[model samples]
Target chain A: MDTAILIDIVKSGLVLGALYALMATGLSLVWTTLGIFNFAHGAFIALGAYLAWQFSSADAWGLPMVPAILLSCAVMFAIGALLHFLLVKPFERRQDIVLISVITTLAGAVILENGLQLIWGARSKQIPPLAEGAVEFGALSLRNSELILMGLVLAILLCVGLFLRYSRPGRSMRAVAQNQDAAALLGLNVPLYFSMVFGIAALTAGLAGVFVGTIRFMSPSMGSEPLMKALIVVIFGGVARFSSPIYAALIIGQIEAFSVYFVGLYWAPAVLFFTMIVVLLIKPEGLFGKYQRTL
Target chain B: MSDLILDVRGLSGGYDTTQIFSDISLQIAEGESIGIFGPNGHGKTTFLKTLSGLIDPWSGDIFFCGQRMNREGERGSRKMRNFNYGAVTRRRIDPKAVARAGLIHVQQGNLLFPELTVDETLSIASTAARGRKGWTLAEVRELFPRLGERGSHKIRFLSGGERQMVSMAAGLMAAPKLLILDEPTLGLSPKVRQELCDAILSVRRLGLPVVLIDQDVAFLEQIIDTLYLFDHGRFSGRMGKEEMPDHQTLMDMLFGEAH
Candidate 1:
């Protein structure tokens, strides 16, 4: 393998990993807090991209990329709060909530996806890059947008880590994740925090969507692929620990990059599925988490 | 009575369709530390949960700090409705609001997050019920010296007594006006129980109200002056501090009766 080729693969893998990390963080947050999978997560990512595009597109609002991303996150947060109250909270205490929430979120996802199609149409769209041109590092030349993508994603993930560790509200959230009853009894507002968790998930998911639009392309149905990949990362990372899925995302990214290079892009999904099955068979608890039966 | 810190009337609450306690009533004056001793599975913990807003009452009123905290409208409506139906429509007490109003419930089994260290647990607890000036980290450190010594150790690594200490410390950090403790010394050895009882006495000295539920009558006798006997989901009656039973005598009465 050429050194330059290896660097390109590593660079691409890191970029892919950043995208997965952002998407998986949202998925993992929702799952850990709500104990229900948000099937609408993919739609959330796609919608975020679409929202950013609407803000930044020369054909639309034509805002700058930074402010557009910010607006996208804010809108995503509001939508998350609304969906949580309207769609998720109603079924929260149901004896079969785990099963029921999926349906509700799936309904939400279908609506959002189709709504995207109705609004944005079926054409593939890409957002304006965060940075134009390419950067050279020795023998390798990297797209400036990809480099920015990796940096921005890593920054967000780092911020999330710090927030959960040191911030009072974040610690309260961690407390809830550890024991809901305890958190509530301590006077932590469980429902409000649940809504906030959804909001955070939406913010992160929405940001990932914008990245996808910049790095790849966005269509109404584009969210499904990334959503599937994120779900795999969450399962591989497990819900017991907060940082587990992050490392899992990066590892999966490298595997994906290498596999796509060695094999073909079309066969990547098969290889990934095979890898997931093997990981599950060997360690049902996840790579960094204790065996926790969620749902 | 200075003020009724917690006043309960016609309190009927339980999990699901099963009524664990029915028409239970109790009162605690300001700065009053009370003990509840009951046989296992007789709704003692459920009563505390109901009071703390962890679970909603089927029919009851909880007046905390002269404010109605628990849902007065519940009044048997939840019981009358379909099973688990209240999950959706039962708009009962928001435990967070209850806690914020200065009533803190120290739950059973310690319930501390296994991943959080004693320091981290206290740090998070400081944010809870932030309306009141909580016990400073220094104050909590003074109250539970063991916590200070092992501040960095995760809860899972702590001893049973240490976990209980962290739970109590966490509750105290919330600056609780009324602290409701459910089995603080459930499975501790006599030495650890004595240590906890002494620490609880220190809390009592600070003029904080406490509601203790424990099988250890000896431990309760050491701290609480008035003891309530809860049996079959009702308060059998209140016992004067002097009238509280010894451990062996209460044990015989509660468990050895069948044998």
Candidate 2:
């Protein structure tokens, strides 16, 4: 490909990768810390997109985009905590927690989709872009909204990293994730930590939804694609390796963006999936995960 | 000297429908150190777990610091199978609650949060011990200087001995009235084991009641003030430090004389 085309593909890839990283990080946290796959995570994203859409609507609450995003995140956080208390925490000690989480979260996904459909209707809704114009450099054009989204993703990631690294509750979360019984003995409130984790995961997913919704459009079923993308990124990055998601997202985004230029749009997702399968088969730990010890 | 910190009576429990141990009773007084000895699968760990509220006793009464313990029911079980079905029973006395109640339990295997720094781990414990006038982080660090040196290091990188020290620090931070340790020296070198024993004795000197369980009779014989030998999930015998059996007799009971 030409240099200009290559740069364009690279730019697109980086943008997509930022969004994917944001989306996948939550899935990784839920999987690694709580051992919950959280299929309903995508549903939270969908809920967020719809909330953002509603915020921008003249007939609705008509809030500013930033506040709207924050409000949506808060709502999803509460919802996530509730889901944990009602569904996740109850099944925490079950050997079948994986299966139960999948089924329960799937049920949540269905409920969210149908509920959105019933409330918002099945029509596709578009969010007002954060910025309207594009920056042209030679043959490559970059949208201002994309840049803003990328910055937002990076900021969110950094904030989460700092919180987990420094905050008392965050440290407790890591402890509980490592060993629940041990965490308890250390005086960490295991259930409260679990709730906090769920809330954080939901908040991240919600933020991703708003970002995606502003750049593109939202439908009740829009979650499926991003859900698949997040899952792929998490798997590629290794569920236990939090930083891996960002790197994996970059790789996947670059491959998809570059391939779309030559092989067409449909082939991009195909290539991403193919890469994921190869990684899973060759290095089951993903690109960054270590071999987990199971008792 | 007769103030009982932990009083477990008629405590019986097992996983699922099976009864692993039955009619178990034990008492720990303030500042007293008790060692639990038993063969594997005889419910020694189970009994400790029951007292810590990790596992429920089938039928029993547990009184901690003179208050009754809300026992675990079928619904509150932490069983993996039951959890998968979304049936987690709320802990009546969760680990935090137990710690807040001035009782601390440290189980075998390094239970440090791999991602947290030693300081952070100790901080959480300190916060939990807020109500109780327990040892401060500085005091705990003084007790384990290695912990003070590695205070900022993540748990995953620590040696087994260091991790145990961190766990001990976390427990001690709470300034518990009763401290329960299950197999603290499970996989440590002899030197580390001795250090751990020293640490346990130090906590005891601080006037904390201690309950210790170890497969090694010799190890307990060094630091324990009292001893309870468990056989098939019941306390087969109890003895004071002065009345304890000779090393040979204890070893014969623990592992049996070869042939």
Candidate 3:
């Protein structure tokens, strides 16, 4: 009931929502562009976390946090592209593509989780905070890490928005998302765009993974929790509408954060899930979208 | 050895084992204007789609600019669909590859990306322009001044005729050696259709080859040098622009015979 406590919850909610927004944006982009649900997205986040942990750990190279996150992101980008060409591409044109992709990506998620376990073991890992200390005023204190996290999320989302709007490949990706056949007719390389989008989506997820890992513990199962939250964010925001996921993430993040203040930690996921279902029942297109079936 | 820009030999294709058309063969000279007309569901669109690499022929070859795009070294040795064998098949070329080779199909029903602004739509094609020497985005804007006026507006808000203009402009921006217009005049007002037809006539005057599919034989007659009469997925008859039959007589041949 304390004002400072409420502000802290709101602050934490914003940070959590930022990570969710980053992860959800990629999921939404991949879904809209490639018409695949990409269940393996969580695995990319997990992979990023493990990579970041490995890079930043003193036992290993122990590189700085920024470089470590960047390295993990690059690797995840390649993984996303490879997954598209190897796994997603062949099934895309089939009538049952959605079902097939879900199954394949779920299997991919299993592979990634187990692979991380094999490499890093089942124990949790965490990176030291990039920035220490907090900014406080009027009984409300915000950690410097929270500021960085918020800045990173906003900056990445803004860059992505500009890319999709002004850049050639970005415009082409939008065209493909609108209509693949039309895009191909324009001599735009659909496969290349698909690969790029998948790579970018993975990169975002990877970045989110590192951000989450730096702030919290990195477990093999850490991605699944955020992945579920991202899915809820995307569904509640709207599939394919880029900005919708971020708005949805913020709202859900606040809900999950403040629900702890009111109801406790266990009730957050249930509350978010129920909210998404109710929104879908009423609008079916989420908070921002024209009714569309991306997959 | 021939002046043909596109040569199709016994082309047959449709959605997964269902043959929409069979043994369809056609040829087009460079800078020629060809029109195909048929009642709905008779595979006029399929023919255009087949040539543009949107669909693979069940059994046949497609030669663009004298290059066999649909078949490889051992002709007829490979099965396109592999019905008898257990292996899946690859299309001879992808749609984008075909477009790069200068076979651009501006599809019917105003299939522009609804979210893309006119300028963005034009830029996507112009940026990806093959070396086929057609209109650039700037030139396209000049050519379709209406599009230039609504340059930054999303295409979904455009009128039916305006959307058609945007579609044609996009195809032109891609710099196609052969432009395929699939039902370009579908669902347009008479005046708008005339305006579109006039623009298409000007395009033909620019000496670019065009293959058009539309039921409005009168409108097609403006730009088409030759016309193919399609019935039940086969070319039943053919005539030049000068020899085009009267509206009632052509209708009888196209629809009355089916009845």
Candidate 4:
């Protein structure tokens, strides 16, 4: 393999890993707190991208690109909270909440997808890169958008990691995740934490959506691919810790890039899933996960 | 006499459709510690749980800091009540509100978040010390030097004794007017239990009211001024530390009720 091409592929893998990490972070969070998968996550991404495009485009809100994306993230947070209240919390105490919430969130996903289509039209849209052109590092030329995307993902993950590790509210969320009864005993509002987790999860997913729209093309169904990748990353990493899915996502991204390089694009996912199954068979908890009480 | 920090009467609670204990009443005055001794699967834990608002009482009242904590009302739909299901006007207890009101419970077995560091657990719990002068982090760290040494380690990775100490320290961080221990020393070795007993004695010295439940009457007698022999979901007998009956008498009390 050419050294330049190898470097490019490796860089692309890192970028893909960054994207997967962002998407999986939210999914991991919702799963940890609610013990339910947010099926609407993909739709949230699609809608988030569409929403940012609406705000940032010269035709609509005419806002700056960064502000537009941030606004879209805020809106998505509300949508996430609404979805939780309407679709998720209703079956919170049910014995089959894990099973039932899937149906509710799937229904919610359909609603969000159609709503995005109705509002934004079915046109494949894309967000312009944060900047035009690529930065040159010796022989390697990296696109400004991909580099920015990785930087932004890293920054967000760092902030969230710090928050969960240090901040009081973050600790409360962990408390709720680790032991709801214990959290309640400490006077931490469990329901409030639930809403907060849903909101923050959607916020991260929305940011990922914005980037996905920038990197690829946005359609109502654009989030499906990223959602699938995100799920694989989350489970392959571990469902509990915030850091596990991230490292797993990075490894999964490298696998995806290498597999796509070696095999055809059609066989990439098969290879990915096979790799995940192998990792799980061995570790069970996850690649980076410890056998601790799940969050 | 010290002011009554907790007053519970006619407290009956259990899981859905099954009553664990009924009309169990107790009072804890400020600076007083009470102990409950009973066999496994009895209502000792349940009683402590009901008082801390971890579980709702089937029918009872809980007064914390002289504030009416649990709202007594008919739960479920009126139709269910008509069918004699949950017909008793149960108490609606929010554990958060109860804990905030300073009724803290150091629950038995996996009480603290397994993934959180001891420092994080204590700091987060300290947030519950609302509207009162609670212990500072420095004070809590001083209270449990072991916790200070193991501040960075996750609760799951800690030894059983360390975990129990962290649990108690977290409870103290809640600035509890009254603390409830549901078998804090249940599974510890004698050395650990002795360490815990010393810690509990230190807490007692700190003048915090406590309600302790343990299988070890000797341990309970060491800390609690009043001992209640709980059996079959009720306080079968009550004795002061001074008048604690012999082992044969205590066994007769337990066996007398079991049969």
> For this target, which candidate reaches the highest TM-score against the unseen true structure?
3
Candidates sorted on TM-score, descending:
3, 1, 2, 4
Per-residue lDDT of model 2, residues B1-259, tens digit only: 2388788778887766678888888888766789987777888887777777777556777788887775544334445544333364445445566667877887777656776788888887886676678788888878888998898898889999899888888888877777888888888999988888888777776667678888777768776889998888788889998888876787687667981
Worst 10 residues of 3 chain B by lDDT: B80-89
* lDDT by residue (tens digit), candidate 1, B1-259: 3388888888888987787889887888876789988888898888888888878788878898889997557644545555545345665888888889889888888757887778888888887757578888898888788888999998989999999999998898887888888888888898998888888888887788789887777778877879988778888768888877777766665556663
- Over B117-176, each residue of candidate 3 has an lDDT whose tens digit, in order, gives 888888888877855676977777666778889998988899988998999999998989
Model 1, residue pairs in steric clash: none
The best candidate in terms of lDDT: 1
Interface RMSD of each: 2.9, 3.7, 3.2, 4.0
- lDDT by residue for model 3 (A1-295), tens: 7777878889888988899999999999998877779999999999887888898899788898778878887888999899887777766666677898899889888998999999889887787776899988879888888898899889999998899888988988899888888888888888899999999998899888888888888888788988888999988989646788888899998999988778888987888888889999999888886676432
Q: Model 4 off-target regions past 4 Å?
A: A291-295, B1-3, B29-32, B77-91, B240-242, B257-259
Q: lDDT values of the candidates?
A: 0.84, 0.80, 0.84, 0.83
Between candidates 3 and 4, the one scoring higher on DockQ is 3
- The CAPRI classification for model 1 reads as medium
Q: Where is model 3 more than 4 Å wrong at Cα?
A: A293-295, B71-88, B130-132, B255-259
TM-score: model 3 vs. ground truth: 0.94
Q: What DockQ does each prediction reach against the true complex?
A: 0.57, 0.53, 0.57, 0.49
Residue pairs with backbone atoms closer than 3 Å in model 3 (clashes): none
Ranking by lDDT: 1, 3, 4, 2
Which digits, one per residue and each the tens of the lDDT, describe model 1 over residues A134-234?
A: 97877989888888888899899899888888888888777787788888888888888888888889889999999988878889988999999999898
Model 4, chain B only, scores a TM-score of 0.89
